[model samples]
Target: MKIHLTSVLVDDQAAALHFYTEVLGFLKKHDVPLGEQDRWLTVVSPEEPGGTELLLEPARHPAARTYRDALVEDGIPLAQFTVDDVAAEYERLSALGVRFTQKPLETGPVTTAVLDDTCGNLIQIASRPR
Candidate 1:
């Protein structure tokens, strides 16, 4: 079996799209209008054009808001993305004015950092040990 699609609840799909693509370097894959000011928007990593897609789902549901709020309140990342080098990525992103909650820290065989997504979520960027 293979993974297909996953999602991150976003307060604003448009803003999320801009951040994920223009900033994080993901490519837009699908964008079908779903009515009521919402769309089925998704993005895929440039390195893996046909790989799993990340859906920028709207957090309009009551339960979704509650869950997202709790996660943010606890300083938890809404999603994680693998990078070639955590420190380099962090430096680049920081230079772009991205706010990070956690700086790159080595934990055993992996290094990770958390940054604000600017659309109501904290996202983690990590690098696995070589």
Candidate 2:
């Protein structure tokens, strides 16, 4: 079996869409209206257009809000995205005024950096040595 879709709890879907697409370089795959000012918005990486999608789920549910807040309070990342180079991605994002909680750091064979998603979540960008 393989992964299909995953989600990241977001306080604002519009803002999340902008960051995920315009900044993070993901492409909007699906955006169907779900009523009540909400939508079934999802994004996919350009390199893998048919791959797994990342849903920008609204954090309206009490449990989801609490969970997101708790993770943020503890400085934990809500999701991670693999990149070719953590440092380069960090620099590119930094230039776009993106705020990072942790600079790129090497940990054994992998490198990682954490950044605020501006949608109430900290997301990690990671790279592994080839």
Best by lDDT: 2
lDDT of 1 at 53: 99
User: lDDT per residue, candidate 2, 41-104, as tens digits?
Assistant: 9999999999999999998998887888888888899899999999899999999999999999
Stretch of 10 with least lDDT, candidate 2: 65-74
Clash number for candidate 1: 0
Deviation (Å) of 120 in candidate 1: 1.2
Model 1 lDDT, residue 75, Cα:
82
Model 1, 30: alpha-carbon shift in Å? 0.5
Q: Estimate the overall C-alpha local distance difference test score of candidate 2.
A: 0.95
lDDT of 1 by residue, 50-119 (tens): 9999999998898987887888888899899999999999999999999999999998899999999998
